[model samples]
Target: MTRHPSDAPTPPPAGTDNGPAVSREEFDALFATVRAWGRWSPADRGAWNRVTPDLVRRATALVRSGTVLPMARPWDTSPGPDNSRPALHYMSELGDLEAAEPSAHKDFIAVDYHGKAVSHLDALSHVAYRGQLYDGRTARDCVDAGGAHFGAVSALGPLVTRGVLLDLPAVLGCRWLTPGRAVHADDLVSAEQALGVTIGEGDAVLVRSGSLRRRREEGAWDPGAASAGLHVDAMPLLAGRGIALLGGDGDSDVRPSPVEGLHSPVHALALAAMGVPLLDNLDLEALSAAGAEEGRYAFLLVVAPLHIPGGTGSPVTPVAVL
Candidate 1:
């Protein structure tokens, strides 16, 4: 059987109703406004500090049907427009060793996960804007050739909390949001109203633009060149809500960026300024269907990353339970 490439529709031309173009001065001011420096004791954990013990218990109470949904895309080993450096997977041992008492088969897998093709978490150290990390840590002073000394993925340990899904395609009555489309703050508010859900402090908010659905239906396109996701304008609303984590099918930043000279303004806002981690390239299609069927968009979310002490981030298969 042959596998089709991931879906990517022809995106609209730039400067066509994308959104208001933001200037560098305005963006810098916005960054300053949202910066959460010196707010938490362990600054590396950033906004995750809001997920208190009570919050964890409350999140646990959200489990109802005992249905579990894994949101990670398959480790894409096939090269395509979307997967440039395809993940590596192969059998190291084929159970043919002569000295072995019992035949044993083993496989090895590796990936450069911090890209469009992998489902992974972004640590605070994963992104630094203007030479600064979260809590005013200098990028050069903290991150080095070995690994990050501050805001590494290890500080984020395991994240267990309430997760909210904003299914934009479902809310807008579309199969998928066209690439280059930008989800704004108003859209978020409308989604909350339509879905009967609210964004609260410590919530892991997942926005679904139906990119994967389009990928499965259409064909592969370079998401690094164009993709649908949240605009920089939406960051203020998320910041105001005090969300713990942000994620989506895309990397949570609209491509052909509206901001001048900034490719991913939302990344800077969420990771560098707000000190919030991000879950990128999640396959939220199953979760979208589950939410529509259950009539509730909130669920208990569990994110367990491999404990790589000095790592910037880790590939993760986050789970949502309802």
Candidate 2:
């Protein structure tokens, strides 16, 4: 059965607010401005190549109290408005059936990630604009049913670097940003000032809009339609900062996207243009509380994706050590 866009569940009740509408021409210009083609040798790893050994060591230095917070959301296997395709989890083997001396329980888990529900990483091959991948590689030539040959997740390896949490709610003295709210570049600057932390090169910047909190307190809704996250106007700022990774409670794009005909504009800008990977649907509530308690937002962020050579991306459990 074919499900139309209107057939999907209605969005959460909220104002119809959105970022300023953007034209395709303006978007193309912005894309060119942030494009980092031919900047690095191994184009597959993209911005992650900036994270040298020294940067990793410096990130480790940020662990003060040694409080570790895992940022991945729990495996969502139940269907809901937010999770349309529930992850699959079933027992593949039960030792009791075998009547073995030693009991061993084996289970199988699978998911069609790359949606609003599961917490996952997006590789450079995940998003392409105008049929082109990062570094101006033709997507059709690199990607096929076997998977991506150019920018697969295996090339990125494990990411270890500094992470900056832009807690927008904390900065604004609110519990959460309202649905359909657009977090602009000025919001990023204000968040830096309020949190007293700076986003620099080779850093993983996590923007928390408290969306999960609202989901917990309220109910599940279609984040694709009305979620609070970064606006398209913010991409240039992140590009200028030379950030290696970007993540958020939402998929990191203001819902009802500012760019006309571009649903995930931030994804296109980050992965397709800037060559930066994205961490989506992260559970940042605990990190927010921990950071607030410690009065520090900078931490050692480590994300080790599964080594799937041809895979475009991977589900990840990103850990933050403060």
Candidate 3:
């Protein structure tokens, strides 16, 4: 797809009644525009169409230029093997339903979702806007007792494409990115320059704000309390480039509110309205350090989110091979 001469502006707030829901006609038109501009063939029309062979070739070229780094923080649930994070517990056994296994066979039967895992990405099914999921799938379609409507961890296919890492902390010369820190479009460009890479259309841009570092060190990375992330100003640039996925090292850059609560602006606006997937809580400190030391950036980015039929985000391991 032809890149916009420059990044577009951020979208309006989702709750604004003036900003009507994107109509079917409007959605179809936009999709058609992207398809025509990208010279996409109908035969390549599934979700994977955005990340074609050419995209993989370019991504691989970047990876071969240097060392590919894994950008996922290790999920630490238990403290001293006793005290554990609640989120981790829910993820591992989905509420301790499998805790009855014998010690010797525990590891064998263990199905802990919260662990030091990687190579995963979030499906559009993970989040929604006004109760609607990606591609207009309803929220109800994603849940069932037997399993997720879409299935788990195996439904998502390989996501291979040109992945750009936007290191905001490095760009700003900050050691840690805080909650509520709003990164604008200029910040993304600045980070791109620091890495000597130009983001392209359909790239899976991973934005790093150093939030993971804080989580690793403090053991408490509260989305509601932390400050970090791209402002709404960065969305247009992302959308205009046909970005297929937006990855980050935290649940979101913006802080959650107690009163006028919004889960995540980036996720809701981009995925539900624009059809882009959001990959969150990634680990990128190691990758950033490696890139800075080598003075090179680019890599074959690979993330295959669990194919849970109707789940939102899955634990993932995102690897960046240089």
lDDT of 3 by residue, 1-322 (tens): 1111112222223211212224445444443333222233321122445777887876776655557577765554444321133233233223355555542222211223422233235555555656765455566766556544542334446688877777766665555655666666776777677667887866878887666665556665345454567655566666677776787776443653211345465666565556666676677878777667666555678886655554545666777886
CA-lDDT, candidates in order: 0.90, 0.90, 0.57
Please give each candidate's TM-score.
0.95, 0.95, 0.70
| RMSD vs true structure, all candidates | 4.4, 6.7, 9.2
Q: How many residue pairs clash in each candidate?
A: 2, 0, 38
Worst 10 residues of 3 by lDDT: 1-10
Candidate 2: residue 101 lDDT (0-100): 79
lDDT of 1 by residue, 188-237 (tens): 99999989899999999999988998888789899988888888889999
Q: Candidate 2: where is the Cα deviation over 4 Å?
A: 1-16
Relative to the unseen true structure, what is the C-alpha lDDT of residue 47 in candidate 2, on a scale of 0 to 100? 98
Q: State which candidate has the highest lDDT.
A: 1
- TM-score comparison, 2 vs 3, better candidate: 2
